[model samples]
Target: MLTFEIMLEVDENKSLEGNVELVPQLTLDCVIFGFHGSSLKVLLLKWKGTEYYSLPGGTVKQEESLDDAAIRVLKERTGLDKIFLRQFYTFGKVERYDRESIRKKLAHLVNPDLWYKRPISVGYYALVDFEEVFPNPDLLSESCGWWDLSDVPELLFDHNEILEKALHALRLELSFQPVGLNLLPEKFTMPDMMRMYEAILGKKIDPRNFQKKILKSGIVIKLDEVKKGVAHKSPFLYKFDANKYEEVLKEGGLFFI
Candidate 1:
């Protein structure tokens, strides 16, 4: 079974001549979110002729499982491997692709007969470090890059809806899971954690109250070190204690969240 970390970068326009043809009725969309130092961004690709941007997507190959296909699509775009993806939602509305603009785009890309088939998309999301990823869109796109979640460009084919749902799913995950663990560095400050959570949660958490609660959770350990070269007293650094985190994972799975 794929443990969700096997990433292999392939040419976005890799031909399907020798391999099995894709199952066109079903598609997978990857909503890759990256954390820049202080803000959250979503990866997007701009198609060759269209001004609209979209999630990295592709058809599921006949020989592969959904997870396998999503991973393949993930690799083709971001070139990252082994990152965990959360299958958040599925969009199967009959009118999903009926938009005139989408129809025009599809006409240029696929057969007229195939476009009539209701294309159901499985939405999956993964978190990656912004500095580590390089946008490598497929042949269909002229460019790809990161867009701040707050200022995402106009999208196509119900893509705006897909992105909204994906962001909602991410917010839900952050409520009970330490989703930030993968997005943030190994070492960081309490304020750093708060900013990420607030960005995802869309609200400011009480600083003093959150600090007391998080420190008491015992999952993060305070270190003796502090950031240097600052005029003010530097805040002490803290890191998630993996040993304690593992113990909790083994003992009924609890986190500071």
Candidate 2:
């Protein structure tokens, strides 16, 4: 079994003039997902003068651990800290470097020498409360925004593949782990939670069945409060009891839809 390594070392002070046998570079990319109403959004940055969208990511520093590097990148790009981030996979495929088309796409930034030494990238996926993040584009990007996952446009590099893998991992996690607490608001209604699950699963879930199943799980705590701003009878607000849910998950008693 291949274990994921989060930390990497690179000498930043070393000159690029030397004909080094290997161009060692460690980079961290995060797929930050946010849930807004019925849409699943992802944070993306648009590079200045470029048509492609890229994930908010940065290279690891010589003195920083991979976890530290990921935190630094997230804060620098999106102003989010202490979110639920997990490293799931490392991508080292040889074809990841075959940049014939990518070079043409990013002609302004591509160099033949750099193209020869494709960097291996590690991906981390984080679920964050959308309202808590105050995102700002980095110096390299002209704009940054949360894009609806359903309408994701042409992304740069191998980000498309990376995002696909992240989504797959997220679905697997949902099956066995209670990971949606961070993606939703602190106080949400059953409909809100159902929409989030449907968005993640990319299908329509029967409303009545969804409510019955999730409610019986005992993971959600019904509050005395009711959702405001509704024309009809307000729905009861609920919050995930993370501690209890995790315990159920560990005991393999948590329900999966």
| Count of backbone clashes, every candidate in sequence | 2, 0
**Model 1 — which ten-residue stretch has the worst lDDT?**
1-10
Model 1 spans > 4 angstroms off: 1-19, 103-114, 228-231, 246-257
lDDT of 1 by residue, 1-257 (tens): 11322222332223343456777678888899888656788889886656767888888776789999889888889888867688899999998876465657644443344355667999999887667788897866768899988899778778899989988888866644456567877777888777887777667788898788667667788888885665688888888886665555455443224
Q: Which candidate is the best by TM-score?
A: 2
For model 2, the stretches where C-alpha displacement exceeds 4 angstroms are: 1-23, 109-112, 255-257
TM per candidate comes to 0.83, 0.86
lDDT of 2 by residue, 1-257 (tens): 22323212223333233333322555678899999979899999886667678888777655667888788788776677678888878888777755677656655543434546656888999898999888788755668899999889978878888898998888878856666788998899999998889888888889998888777777899999999997799999999988877877787664444
Looking at model 1, the pairs that clash are 5-82, 7-81
Local distance difference test, each candidate: 0.75, 0.77
